[model samples]
Target: MVRKKLYRSKKKLGQAPGSVVYTGERPKEKLFLEAFDFTKDTYTEKQLTNIEDCFEYKHTETVTWINLNGLNHVNAIETLGKHFDIHHLALEDIVNISHRPKLDDHDSYLFLVLKMLYYNNSHNLVSEQVSFILGKNYVFSFQEAEGDVFNPIRDRIKNAKGRIRSMASDYLLYTLIDAIVDHYFNVIEVLGDKIEDLETDVFTNKSSDNLSIRIQDLKREILRVRRAVFPLREVISKIVKNETNLIQNQTSTYFKDIYDHLTQITENIELHREIIGGLMSMYLTSISNKMNEVMKVLTIMASIFIPLTFIAGVYGMNFKYMPELEFKYGYFAIWGLMVIVFLVLLFYFKRKKWL
Candidate 1:
């Protein structure tokens, strides 16, 4: 899958720097743009289906968030770039799904790219690239599709919950990043539960069939999560220490908090990777021990049968001049000798602890 995405990104190799070729799969859901404009005392949120109406709030003094969901609409995004004076490369990154998570600071706006991860209806992990363009009084958030993990933050802005309404656009940026960071904890918790279940199954169940495939899937998910999260250390570090006026001094502390959370998340990811390594070793050892036990049983059975086969072979070589053939007691004596030999070998094996 990663190779496939890289192939898609290569389509724009020789083109202009800001070309708008979407290197992602065509979206299933339609495009949508929701506008949220609010002051300290007043609040308004509206879903704007018509992309052209987004221009109205650009001149508003209130803090406005123009969330443009579904990046498949290249013309609407181009329209936004024209209205807001957004750089063409920024627009290109917004449409390109394979863009790595990064922070690009402009003269008038700060652009941030991040991955939003969530489990879809089928319980499979799915992620979308979310791009944010933060201006002085207005902020633009672009997503690949209509849904989001930002519903709680939306509710807070609507009810004027906490200091979100009273803060500047940079503050809104902090809250948005904070919301994203908080969601990581939820993701790791879900992963912890899954790891616990896999551990239990591997240790207790005799049939650990398909365990390797499941573990590989989990490690891939962890790698994806790490890729989604680990780079933020540098990205947020840049934001916190940045000299740009786009991030205020007071809000730097909030970003610092997010950086701390990212640090903790990275440690958890490392621990999970270690656990996966241990499970792999345990699985191989278990198989080896099981094989050893089967080999030991077969070895003991072979030891007991070898001498009996030798005695039978000797008695079956009959000759007319054989002295024992004339005696009636010969058959009984041979049977007794065979029984004695078997018992002696069994005792020796028992004494040697080979059985």
Candidate 2:
């Protein structure tokens, strides 16, 4: 039920463009850096204690993947950007986590922003902005937190199980992007499950007091997922059609595969939107129908009692000169007549299926 705010801080409101401002909340955990340098014949992985420790990997002939966990540290981001010759604007976008998925192609490198999505321990969807700087021999990745969906890619690199060790840095970039896009399927599947549960509750009349609230929450979640995912289509499209040296010709094919995945993901997102809309309408309709049935039963009971009340009211009238009052069988005959009337009405109602 939490709606994420756009700007966590106003520190960058009046600041100039290309200003490196960390707009997100500061984490208690310190900044962490992990470096993976690998080639066809050799592979090495290290956990660096300081940002300066990773500066040497820039000049290495082998492909390097430098991942930084904490974005709340502005000094470390500025220093890293300065050391790598990354554009000031790119660094600004990196610190601004609210920025959507996009691509900035430079002559020397390509800067890309993407949303990494996954479910947390509580099964709530969590999104983190992941920015990547793809250079000739190194790929620099900046993230908001530590855990991500790239563990499979990491295992592949560590075990040297695939062509990742043999491919160039461009192919490595493709693999990284592919990993993120693959996790989108998992998120979308969770959305589909939610839609099914909503449908079940609506159809089976098993709705709870908070059913509507849950539906609204699901709607907001869909919006979040869409916001995180939809724009990536353009980002991938740019990479596929990009003419930069950072993205090689062979790797363009692999990026196209990512494009296809995005297309499928967007289609599923739209489908989920429609289904959620239908569920809201169905829930409302079910509630309305339930009320109508209750009203119908009450109306039928009132119809059956009106005539009986009229008979009782007529006989209860005071009349001292009334001849029926003097007759001995008058009370019994009146009782018989009332019972007949009641039976006849009951039979008629049963024939009409009013009961």
Candidate 2 residues lying further than 4 Å off, grouped into runs, are 1-11, 316-339
Q: Spell out the clash pairs found in candidate 2.
A: none
Please provide TM-scores, in order, for all candidate models, with all chains considered together: 0.91, 0.91
The sequence of per-residue lDDT tens digits that candidate 1 reaches over residues 1-355 is: 8798777868788988799877777656588888889999998889887878888887789999888877888888999898989999999989998877899889898989998877778878877888999998988999877777888889999888999999999988888888888888888887888888878877985546788888888989888899999887888999889657799889988899999999999999999989987877777787787888799879887877788888778777877787877889999998898899889988998899877
Candidate that scores best on lDDT: 2
Model 1's alpha-carbon lDDT is: 0.85
The residue-level lDDT of candidate 1 at 150 comes to: 86
Model 2 compared with the native: what TM-score? 0.91
Error of 1 at 121 (Å): 3.1
